[model samples]
Target: MGSLRESLNRFNKQQEKCQSTLTSIAASAAGSKASNRTTTTPAPRAVPASTLSKSPVPAVKFSNDTERLQHINNVRKSPVGAQIKKVIDLLFESRQSFTAEQINEACYVDVKGNKAVFESLAKNPKVNYDGKRFSYKSKHNVRDQKELLKLIRTFPEGIAVADLKDAYPTVMDDLQALKAGRQIWLLSNFDSQEEIAYPNDPRVPIKVDDELKQLFRSIELPRDMLDIERDLQKNGMKPATNTAKRRVMAQNGNILNKPKQKKKKKTEISKRTKLTNAHLPELFRNLNG
Candidate 1:
């Protein structure tokens, strides 16, 4: 029993020593002056949390958040938000992919505002972060004609020029190029006072000559104007306008009114015909008398 108690007392002493050593080590690691202190005890080596605290990470701190909010808001409203906003705005405005590093470099915001907003954007839901880059959702960078045409087609009513300007700064030039290529049409909307463009519809307009050919083939006689129009449409031929039908009818009328060639009178070919053929010799003698 005595040996047992002695062993237990030694174990308790060792445990207390270990705890004191650990406390000293934690304190030393937490502060810089700890390394200078002399110690009679050996400390166990382990990984530490202090190193993680020193990285140059962007952050916004709050003590009394209620009071800090106005300051934070001021920062956001003033330039921090604006700076970060410009980064995204330009990115969205440029309508292309941009990295956070690129934004950090190109931003022209004032130092204080620039600093706060740049860091805060990482958490902003309005900004799309793909680990390395940022982008605005509604606007996409269009680099070529095919992509531009595709975007216009996606919006049926028409994409507003104002909205497109945010994504495509030079939308007019692009639309003009598309128009010149015969890939789209630029239409003026008077009510809204907005000019819009749209891709060509799949339906093709039929030629007037083609329509005339088909109409004549299908009908042998004159038909009512309305009936002709309906039949032409029913036959999958588009005259394109009401005037086209009128022109066709006028042309057909000229054909029907053409003057007929007269036939030669049929009579016996005999002595009379022979005398007429020899008219000069016999008629000359009579004339002389």
Candidate 2:
């Protein structure tokens, strides 16, 4: 009798599951018929992030293609959707931010409507706004590994990683991937965190006095460098790191200057000179003057 009671309980659960399945199917079928009968546009359904997940292959399950197109038309007719579409189209044309005025002109929407859509959509995680302009947030717009490397080279003091993440959330994984590969470095001090992609470590910006800048005008070798550094240290000077040395070179506006090639001394050749003249070009002889 106990075994029979257990079997009955199992059957009741199975019956409930079957009823739930039938209810879902019937609801879907009824939705299809309602979509076919309705001529008016229904409210736009918000597509969930789960629905947008990338799939390897496309699958179309419903026969609601006509209804879908009509819904799309309704979205286009709606002010908010139309404005968002304008922003998308503008981004496709130019990834640069579009000003409210520019969008109003191009999309032919009134200023008030444009402002409303911009303010609303600006809250979206994927929409980017700069107080006055709008753009679609994209990873490509953010500094990639190569660009971060370039930034490392440019700003030797290092870039705040948090600031970079704020600018490009999409590239967070890319940045982490590069970090994992040891292609870049994440560093921190007492107050801040930064990324350094260049091989040379970045140093804090320091003001170099003219005398020190003159001393490091050209790179000094170990002996001269040690002597100069020792002498400067006696005067309470900080030893110049590579970044400091570069800053000095840049302050003088010649960091990018190529080393001056030694000019061959042109000796001036006398028109009436003999072998005693030690023949050389007249220009060479005149170089001493």
Candidate 3:
């Protein structure tokens, strides 16, 4: 029992010495700083909520709608002014009511994505939109009142107000003004169901001007007109009346109302006259008083 106790005490003392040595080694290692030693501790680099909350916020970019509008305004004031004027003139001259899409088609513009041309057209005083469609005010009336009267006098077949309205919606107003002034007498077939007339119909006869007359006359009669009419009758091949008129004018510019060559009459010589040709000397003899 004495040996057993001595062994236990010795074991305890050895354990205590070992623990002390381990503690001393740990302290020495912590105190020592080597030139090439790497720290095992991880760095605390995450952004804290307090620092993030105080940082400046970035600015946002926005579209300049005013600048876009100003750009459109500038386009209106440019040389395109003449083009717009011409388009307006055509709407009246053709006596055709045009929708926004039609106007764009006439101008060779694509208004599906582009708004400038459409917005510009809306600015005209005569431009009125009936919810679904757009049309001009003075479609049927000639811009010059004198011209309108002259045309009516020349072709007394008289025009439908709707036809004129289609070309120039203000034609009725202009004609009314003329009536009020006692300048011209106009007739309407409006009440007659036999003559169908609509508000947007352009009723004026497509006039054959001297230039067009000359152009048509230069070509052989029924042939040229037939060819053109037949071509125009084709599906999807028909051009606007105004476009067709212009095309004809362009093609026949230099050619005027020159007459076509007629077939010559062939005369046959008489058998007796052929025999008389041989007896010409005998025919010269007798002179009677």
Candidate 3 displacement at residue 119 in angstroms: 17
TM-score of each: 0.36, 0.26, 0.24
Task: Estimate, for each residue in 1-289, the C-alpha lDDT of model 2 and write its tens digit.
Answer: 9999999999999999999999999999999989887856677889998779967687868775897667645554677766676666665456567776776566544434546775666775556777877777743344466665555456556656655664443556866776786556667654343453333433544568998888787775556566667777899998764455666788988747588899899666455445454564554454322
Angstrom error of the Cα, residue 197, model 3: value is 3.1
Clashing pairs in 1: 80-113, 95-141
User: Model 1 over residues 179-263: C-alpha lDDT tens digits?
Assistant: 8887778887777888787767446754679878898898775455666677788999975458565788887883666698899
State the lDDT at 228 in candidate 2.
69
- lDDT of candidate model 2 versus the reference: 0.64
Worst-scoring 10-residue span by lDDT in model 2: 193-202
Instruction: Give the candidate number with the greatest TM-score.
Output: 1
Higher-TM-score candidate of 1 and 3: 1
Q: Which stretches of candidate 3 lie over 4 Å from their true place?
A: 34-195, 198-289
Question: CA lDDT of each candidate?
Answer: 0.66, 0.64, 0.59
Model 2: CA > 4 A from native: 1-133, 136-143, 192-289
Q: Which stretches of candidate 1 lie above 4 Å from their native place?
A: 1-77, 92-101, 108-127, 136-142, 154-157, 206-289
Ranking by TM-score: 1, 2, 3
Better of 2 and 3 by lDDT: 2
